[model samples]
Target chain A: SQQGEEDPQALSIQEGENATMNCSYKTSINNLQWYRQNSGRGLVHLILIRSNEREKHSGRLRVTLDTSKKSSSLLITASRAADTASYFCATERGGGTSYGKLTFGQGTILTVHP
Target chain B: EPEVTQTPSHQVTQMGQEVILRCVPISNHLYFYWYRQILGQKVEFLVSFYNNEISEKSEIFDDQFSVERPDGSNFTLKIRSTKLEDSAMYFCASSGGFEKLFFGSGTQLSVL
Candidate 1:
């Protein structure tokens, strides 16, 4: 099983609506990063929140991290059709061997209807 | 904004043949990494390079795989003997100080 897992593998939302996706992980992490990917392309860094930090925001993207639950959520406010893509959460886990390397989640495919 | 760039957007090679994928990471960034994702699978980290050496690598990065920052801007990942399982989209990413990473468009390799 993957270290990070995202819920609602697929989501559909109307334009101007908000889309929220959740990610759960198994281990302790130093930080969690969110990335957006268009079809057939690479990921684009969206936002990152450290374990010590609870929430962060950039533009319409809002990210929240809960270390106690070992989970995070990305909220896209007033999503447009252009925001349609897959969103993945990657974690930098704690410990010796797996430090600094990111373990990605299965990802949630988001679709915005115009 | 600076973006990482990769060449040979798509390549097709035969089994057992050697293939080299190239990436030009964002200038002034010191950390470089290589990741791959097979179709319908999550992205997996292969290796991370810093200070002209490998800082960390996943189990997927085996003896057949190698990464080099042969020059200032270009970082390359080479596979000695390609197998069918090697068919996937390879992504290159770089970070400056913090963990805010930027990724290249990616190079899709198809092993026949």
Candidate 2:
């Protein structure tokens, strides 16, 4: 089952623009992670933000998590044509056999025009 | 960077026929998992395995589905009787820890 719902099902922008996608999830989570999937390919782990951490960054990607609102956002700085892909937010619920299972969001599809 | 590897990039089988999907997780990773994504849908978790036993599974994983760590490196998901709805892209993943996961390219199963 899906635990999170991403807003803006699709987005189109030119290169060099920043793209932001939001995700809202139900239930408390130990961590929220973002992944990227190229068309017809596997998912690539992008970043992970623990429940205690508000924000985290890796390279051009930034992720923010807010447990209070049960929401999170992913930001791609200086987006490029190569950054065009589907982004998904996955949550790992806290405790009780939730260990390695991840519930993913519907995903946001971003198209970067070069 | 080691990766999780899945075999038979694409499989076509008739409904009611049994199918087996194979995966080889990173050598050092202890946790293994199976997930499926139907075309144009969210990725759904199927099962997770650790210490040679199933740690958790979703309701979607009925009696028809079974997982096996047949050897030290190979993990397999077997569907006893495939249904038309069983068609989807199945991904195998592994994690050394509980947070970050490495996913395989996936196997696209088509049950006709």
The numbered model that scores best in lDDT is 2
Model 2 lDDT at residue A37: 96
- Please provide, for model 1 over B5-105, each residue's C-alpha lDDT reduced to its tens digit, 9 standing for 90 to 100: 99989999999999999999999998899999999999999998988999889889999999999989899999999999999999999988677878999
Instruction: Score candidate 1 by TM-score against the native.
Output: 0.96
Note the residue pairs that clash in candidate 2.
none
TM-score of each: 0.96, 0.98
* Interface RMSD, model 1, angstroms: 1.9
Give the worst 10-residue stretch by lDDT in candidate 2 chain B.
B93-102
Backbone collisions counted per model: 0, 0
**Model 2 alpha-carbon miss at residue B57, Å:** 0.5
Error of 1 at A90 (Å): 0.5
Report the C-alpha lDDT of model 2 over A1-114, residue by residue, as the tens digit: 348899889989999999999999988899999999999999999999999999999999999999999999999999999999999999998576678789999999999999
Give the whole-model CA lDDT for all candidates, comma-separated: 0.92, 0.94
As a whole number from 0 to 100, the lDDT of residue A94 in candidate 2 is 52
